[model samples]
Target: MIDLLLQYGLFLAKTLTVVVAIALLMMAAVRARRGMGGSDDGDRLEILDLNERYKSLEQALKESCLSKKAYRAYVKAERKRRKARDKAQTEERQRLFVIDFNGDLRATEVAALRVLVTTILLDRRDGDQVLVRIENAGGTVHEHGLAASQLARLRAKGIHLTVAVDKVAASGGYLMACVADRIVAAPFAVIGSIGVLAELPNFHRLLERHGVDFELHTAGEYKRTLTLFGENTDAAREKLKGQLEDTHGLFKDFIREYRPALDLERVATGEYWHGSQAVALGLIDAIQTSDDLLLTASETTDLLQLKYSAHKKPIERLLASLQSAVAGRLAAWVGR
Candidate 1:
């Protein structure tokens, strides 16, 4: 009889556990449905009302009709209200997209920029601005040039575009920076290296020492201008120099067309200047960091920094922490 009672108790416990598991699963499903759900019509109506209010406030502020103190107070209150409304209406409105490029100019960076620009073109409302925080030391001509052209498309669509350079923007990087409606640079950011360069090491002597030979072939007269193997001729050197000169001329022309106020001859001397010096040369308009610009713009327009990062999941974070702890223990053991 006791054995039978024990069996019954085990069965009851299992039944209860299964019931609890099912209940938890149902709760999770309900929450997931809510998170993935679309905004209701009522929410849309609320957003439209808030937008109308924002427009009214903007118009009032523009006409200089309010006293200074009143204007400040109104703006402060309005911004607070708008922020709350936006947070509540997150399901109804689109988010501001920010593209951050902080590395070498490569295909991945270009592709990211392309997608960003395309998104802005599709999602940006009228009067919205696209901010590009660019930090590049420059790279291949064609690569960076393509990136700049992508930014130019924003301007073509009547969208406002601003580029903030926090570090060096030299050579091809400057090409990208020129397309912005306004360029803001950090106080000591490196700006303007309007030049092109090509370098090759001739291995003729090194190969001779090793008693090795290399063959060369060419279909066109200037197919291989500064080569690493064959003897370099005056003709080849001159040809390469001419190509560099042509590229430089194109770079100068592009800058002049975009920033016509700049004295191209004076500033395009393959010289890099600090941010303040760049302002004097008309390379950049203002010496302000992106943080300052964003803060100031927030007072006038809605300021946002958008990023697409592959954040670590909870399990991944836990594993990483565990691995770090193990490594630390191993190092301590070695020190002992």
Candidate 2:
């Protein structure tokens, strides 16, 4: 009974925190909407040097909860050697511009993507390379297409573009990845799903059962072929199917234009493959993880991670707060 009460109390606290976070966000959004958002910094750019990240890694290693015998021995020697060499080499001959793309179903990161790429184009010069670490399970067609086009801009500048997939890149994700000069993925990371897909629930029958009527008007005959509340005709369904086919064809053409080595007919069948399998199908150029790629780049080049700093909106702050709270609670629960 005591434990149950404690759990309930914790749950209530978390719920209240989330509610407060959301309320603050709503207030902030309303103020911004009314042009009264004083001091709300729009987005800003944040650049993190990969070599400097080792400081955090060293701290984390020291705080490891796992058995640290073999790991400590190896990392200790490497760290000492790296420290000795760091003083001698203040700069590298080649520089790698790293961008991270963590996408959602709507390709929400496309705005950041555009900003980062444009900045690189303006500032980067010869002997520089762009490495995009992308983790996306694909998203809306036009949105991801725009994201891929943003990547294409780097390629157009004769920049050596390398895409590193750490987790998964399918559908629209693969669309963007294929635009790179090289695609690298982990041994078991998901790579390809070069197919277009769209789905929406239709409520026409439910509306009919409820005796509710819905009428939609459009300028063209095909303006709104299939709708959520309207009865879909056979023609409407066929038209949607035809549109999907056309989109798929363009997807294939785009990939072929960029990655001519890939066998489009086989890989573009809406089937996803792991890194090794993708490499075998010529969908991915190499089988390696993004972490390894970053470490390698740090050795041969100055690795700089690019991020667009934007003044966090109310919702963004709220989300970050919620994430931090949840992580803290989870860590406590795990005794970590």
Candidate 3:
């Protein structure tokens, strides 16, 4: 009896802790929404000079590995070489603007991507190139389309656009990648998955079992074809399936427009391939990681990493930290 009471008490405490955490999160969100105001320095275009950063890294490594005399000699020679190169190149050096897109299910990064694209369109110089490093498996259709359109904007203006994928770039991710003049990927990076998918749970039978009625009204015939509560008919199912096929048709056409050489019949099967296979399949031009590409380009070109950062309130920061902590704990627990 005592052990049972102890177990129940522990369960109650756990429940109360969860409830309090959720309540606090809700309150914080409400306050943050109400108090949010204008943007500041925290929200702006942040550019990192990859060339200087790489030079610093190289200098640090040499300083650690070489004797003081040897390091000084190396620095002197490097400065002389740089000075000579700069003197010879009296004209403006070409620039390579590097952009990164880490996409999610909603393609929220499009907000920043559009801004970066607009900025580049305004400030781009002759012979300037854009290298977008993308790490995304896939996402929603319309959102990814918007993201892809931003990349296309560069190509539209006759600016060379290169996309590098160190990881996965399947489906909607590949959609954006296809817009690039050249696509590079790490050997094992996942590529392709040109497909459309939509799914939802139906609780009609469950509600019926509980004697619950769900009434749904719509003006159009196909407007409410699929629902979570209302009974789904064969006609409704057929209509939904037809809509999916129509969407898939549009997806294939879009890819064909960008990559005309790709065999749509073979690749548009809703399947994915790694980098090497992708090359043979014409999904990617080369098998190379973004880091290697950037490092090599830094030698001859001014590499600038561009990103738009949004300002976040203190409450938002706190909430993000809390979410990250919880996610880490949950991941650890699951791993165990």
Error of 1 at 265 (Å): 1.0
Q: Candidate 1: TM-score?
A: 0.65
lDDT of each: 0.74, 0.83, 0.88
lDDT of 2 by residue, 1-336 (tens): 999999999999999999999999999887887696455556688888887796578667665853678667767877888798877876656889999887666676788889999998888778999999887777689999999999999999899999998778888888999999999999877777778776899999999999999999899988887899999899999999999999999999999999887778788898888888888899888998888888877767878888896667789868756654553343233222
List residue ranges in candidate 2 displaced over 4 A: 1-42, 55-92, 315-336
Worst 10 residues of 3 by lDDT: 327-336
Q: Where is model 1 more than 4 Å wrong at Cα?
A: 1-97, 105-107, 308-336
> Against the correct fold, how does model 3 do in TM-score?
0.83
Choose the strongest candidate by TM-score.
3
**lDDT (Cα, tens digit) per residue for candidate 3, span 77-172:** 999999999889988889999999987666777889999999999988889999999877676899999999999999999999999998778888
TM-score of each: 0.65, 0.74, 0.83
Least well predicted 10-residue stretch by lDDT in candidate 2: 327-336
Q: Model 1: per-residue lDDT, tens digit, 88-140? A: 86443433334676545342367557766775687668677787888776767
Ranking under TM-score, best-scoring first?
A: 3, 2, 1
